[model samples]
Target chain A: MNPVKVIINKELKVIFNSLLFYIAFTVFFCTTGFIYWLSQGNIFYTGQASLGYLFTVFNGVLFFLIPALTMKSISTEKRDGTFQLLFSKPIKTWQLLAGKFFAILIQVLLCLALTLPYYITIACLGHVDHAVGFCGYLGLIFTTGCYISIGIFVSSLTSNPLIAFFSTFAITIWFQFLFEMLSSWLGNTFIASVFMYLSVNDHFDTISRGIIDSKDIVYFISIISLFLALARYVICKSRI
Target chain B: MNVIVKDLTKIFDYQKAVDSLSFEAKKGEILGLLGPYGAGKSTTLKMLAGLLRPNQGSIHFDNYTYEKNESKIKKLIGYLPEKNPLYDAISVTDFLFYMAKLYDIPRYKVTSRVLDMISLCGLENEKHKLIKELSKGYRQRLGIAQALIHDPEVVLLDEPTTGLDPNQTFGIREIIKTLGQEKTVILGSHILSEIENTCDQVMIMSKGQIMAQGTTAELRQAPNSDFSLKIVIKGGEIPAIQEALNQLPQIKSLQLQHKQEFEVHCTPGQEIERAIFELCKDNDWYITEMTPVQMRLEDIFRKVTQKQ
Candidate 1:
């Protein structure tokens, strides 16, 4: 494998070797299953089942899980002094960030995969919109990518993993809830529309409702790329 | 593999870590950086490895400037930082392979090259173990193994034996001695004896500047006005012994401060001992031991830095 793939593999191995990834996976699965069961009422949603509920549930769950997964991306490297060793080599800064970012992607994917049993249950119970469910998953992935990128950027800012986790969790939660709180203050003005539109929760909610708007997809991709770029810049400057 | 550092300087807030420092290392030769703590040794090494940009100077590797050919320079160089930077959870084998991959070594070749490095550093049995579980000596070996995995042309080791036990120190010293046979090596340490034993040349750094740079023979030959001689005297009046030794013909000047001791300065290479022996024969002030105290590297470092 090339350096990027090699680094990705190394990081994946490290993530799997630790018990944190498993813990995050178990918690996400248990919570999503419980919520799905509760939302079913006594008959477990005999009507058409939509993926929107799953998206909402996972969004809340990722608010905690993403920070847990990405808190050590750069912080652990710095604390262990391994950052200097990596910098001394011939590889560029962007490759390392991409490698680590993809590693976090694999973990998020695994957590999503653990919900397979829930998907099977949904398919067995009643009619479901398979296309909308797939699109909803694509949207969840897009938003989670943005969250992990933001988390990685926050991780690069400090060597303390707890601080990285808290900062990332706080920023993600703030971005998700800021506009809702802003609307109450602005009294539903036109400016509140822009704030609400800019919020990640708003964009994710729009896409999870079986609507594939280009603008929502673009917003998620751009936010992820921007944070990943910032993370690259931060690590480069700090390494030098 | 030649390195030229010109007027390099780095200032941190109120202190200059490297202050107009300049030096050069020739191809296939070991250059020892000797200095006490806070003497800019680590800072200088960091700049050389391109991990830090100098504040006010240029570094050139061969004919290429450091900035213009950073990737090329990094490919040709291997650096072992003062603090051993190994991932605790990574096995020795995996770490070496990771570094080799970074250097663009072929996938099929990385394994054999890694094995060669492990063997060269005598880390064969511990190659499968996690780095954090290894003893300090073994961890140091792994550090060297990683640095040499790609077989870079220039290897810079900072305090490679700083915390190792005596046997470990000897092992590191031996590896360095062998590495010097094929690759140009630069090591930074405050231990003067290690430099004297392993390096072909020494550069003494102090307060962000190089005080002296030369081979041991060349440094010993630097002009000095005074030479020390430790002479043991047999039973005799201390005053008489000093008086007899002062009358030697080759002595330019003499001082009789102690009863049995006297400090004498003479022309370089002049033999004043014969005259002293002749003068002392009558009084039976036998000379027990005669040794010349020439200027050493430590003396030069202390004298130059103290003057600064």
Candidate 2:
């Protein structure tokens, strides 16, 4: 058996068994459902008849949701000595990091899969561009990969899951929102462009426009690899 | 597997946790590592198990050195770290099967192997229960089962019985003894009596260095300058036994202390226990008891470690 698959199976089993997953699943769908349908700023109330906010609003929910999902991925194992059990096995640090990253990514994908009905509902009511919605989902997944990597990296820094979650949140809030805002507010064009390029939201925005640019893809992949690499290094150093 | 660790050292926080420790373990031997808390017993085992990369030295299992060939070495060893760690959310059966998969056991063989481990560790009754619901003993059993699921040749158990009650420790100890009959087992603990009762060979470690390593009897006799033996013979043949003892070249001196009791002193570097019994067999004299008097393991360990 591949070590990554074995780990993913364990993570999925734990996630499915957890009541907290169900709670998060509920809160996520409820908030998204309310925002897109019943709320005053909703597409339904504004008669826009488009699910344009789906990616952006869901990304907002995921900003907090993913850190909670990934906080214990590495930290809890370290705290309870399960990492010792794992490190003793014939697996590398990269396998451990990849296994955990994809485990939380799959959970996020499952939650997104549940919201497919909303997409169907919106499609039935108005003229929706299928290509654009597809790109939005793709961008959402790419951005999630970046966030999961960040979460796992922070989780490896400490044994406390709360610290992992909060540090991840603190770091990602800048990537997810603050950097993009800072980029626009800055008067210097060079500094603004650097922040703009660095921000996850900006790259995600480019991809979310239904355009699959190679540069944007490279940006997300680079961010994911960088954080995952950092996480692997942290785990190796800490275990030694 | 015949295991050799040479100059195995690990430095943590600028202090050497395991300092140039070296030892050899023969195939199918149960070697107990006795040490105080933080004495590097676990660290040495971890280095052998490939959990920790040693700063200096090498661990060689037969022809394969650990640093040169890790995956091959890993397949030959199973390590259960100090605190027995397990996934509490998973059922016992699921966890074992998962471990079988992790060990890369063939898909068809996983069930039977897991069943064997479940029975071997006495976890059959709790096989369906979640690990979180288990008592401390059950958890420890599960930990051992995972360590053995793949049938590795070298099994490392660090403080396996640390927090268990006597009964729980007994169960794990029995399993370890059974494993020792066919596998090289390294049992690490700070408990003097635990090592004495369970291990065939013992290595006393302190301050990241090995103070001494030998069989219990050898270690007991190693430190004693005077070699003494107590013999009890039937038919009250005191003079005959004393004369027979006097004829042996290894016997430095012999005396009949009582009618049925005789004491023989052996020269240095002589193992007289086997020779005395052989002498009784040859003379047609029935020996009721032949005991080698020596220091206890506790005394030997304290004496060897504290001196350094």
Candidate 3:
């Protein structure tokens, strides 16, 4: 078997067995469910069967949820000295990171898959744009990949999971909101355009609106690759 | 597989944890790394395990160098790091299976391998229990089991018996001795006697440098090595006996433990025993007891490490 698959299997088994995963899943399910059905801008209030509002709420909730799920991925391994066990095996550092990245991504995907009933219910009530829903889910998946990579990167920077959690949350906040805010405040300057391009929310907004632009896809892929590369670099440098 | 390490060095912050250290171990040999705390034994073992990259060194297993064949070398090595770090949340069986899979054991073979380690490590009763619930001794055994789960040719163990009871230590030593019969094993410990009893070759290190390296008997026979004898005489007066023992050129010093018992220090490679027997025969002192005390590894360890 591939070592990455072994790591992924172990990681998933560990996560699923821990109480933390269930709590994160519950909080995600509840918060998104309440916002979609019972909150002020709920579907009942808007009288619209579209999942646009629910996708926006998911975008907001996942900002914190992804970090929660990924906080312990690498940092805990370093803290527990299990990195020695993994690194000493016939496994490359990238394989280790890739395994963890996909394990956590699988978790986020599982959580999202559980909410498919919301889509079905909305479709039953009124005519729903299947294309928009599919694109919105794709956007969330890309956003999840981007956030998970960032979380794993920050996780590699420290041996403390709390620090990994907060740093990831703090960094994603910048990409999700602060960069966009700063770009708007700069009034369309070249640096502002760079900031806009850097903002994860900008690309997510474009894709979630039922339009899959190559530029947006490229933005998410580059961000994911950049952070994964950075994470690999951090691990390599620190192991010495 | 024979393992060779050359000029291995690891610096943390600005301090050298392992200086330009080097050694070699052939198949069927157990090379013990003996040192006090902060003497870089663990650092050296970590480098050998390929978990830590050396600042200036190279390691090779048989014909494969780490620089060119890291994975190949890793597949042949089994390392038990200090403190026996394990995944506490998993069962003993799960942890071993996880390790087996990580080492790329065939799917059909992993279960049997895990079972073998569980039995070899004496962890059959605790196989279903989570590792967190295990005692320190069981944990150490589990650590060794995981290191050996893949049946690697080279085993590197860092302080494998650090916190075990006498019985547990004996069990671990038995396992190590069994491993040394067929594989190249490098064992690191600060405990001198453990190394003396278990290793084929001993390397005494201090401050990241090797102070002495040789077989146990070779180290014991080094120049300036001294032996002692405990003698008890029945007939001679204390002063006369002391004088007679002192007159022997081979006897260095004498201490009277009780009225009739005397402790005599003798220069190494001397006929002090025969000389004392002859002296007692001439003086009409009846010899009751005489026991030779061999030079201990502790003395050699202190002698070499304290010099620096």
lDDT of 1 by residue, A1-240 (tens): 566887898898666767867777888888877777775542355354656776778778877889998999999888888887888888777888889989888888888888877777877877778877887788788889989999999999999999999999888986678766786578868998777766888888877777889999889888889998998888877644
* Model 3 Cα interface RMS deviation (Å): 0.9
Per-residue lDDT, model 2, residue A10, is 88
Candidate 3: tens digits of C-alpha lDDT, residues A113-160: 978989899999999999999999999999999999999999999999
lDDT over C-alpha atoms for residue B27 of model 1? 74
Q: Residue by residue across B63-119, what tens digits does model 2's lDDT show?
A: 998657887877778888898988899999999988888788899999999999999
What TM-score results for chain B in every one of the models? 0.89, 0.79, 0.91
CAPRI-style class, candidate 3: high
- Residue-level lDDT of model 3, residues B164-213, one tens digit each, is 99999999999999999999999999998799889999999999999999
The reply for model 2, stretches above 4 Å from the true place, is B223-293
Looking at model 2, residue B299 earns an lDDT score of 81
lDDT: worst 10-residue window of model 1 chain A: A39-48
Task: Quantify all predictions' global Cα lDDT against the true fold.
Answer: 0.83, 0.88, 0.91
**Interface C-alpha RMSD after superposing true interface residues, each candidate, one decimal:** 1.6, 1.2, 0.9
Which RMSD does model 1 reach against the true structure? Answer: 2.8
Q: Which candidate should be chosen as best, given TM-score against the real structure?
A: 3
Per-model TM-score versus the true fold: 0.93, 0.88, 0.96
Residues B160-198, candidate 1: write the lDDT tens digits: 998889999999999999988888899999888788889
Give residue A68's error in model 3 in angstroms. 0.9
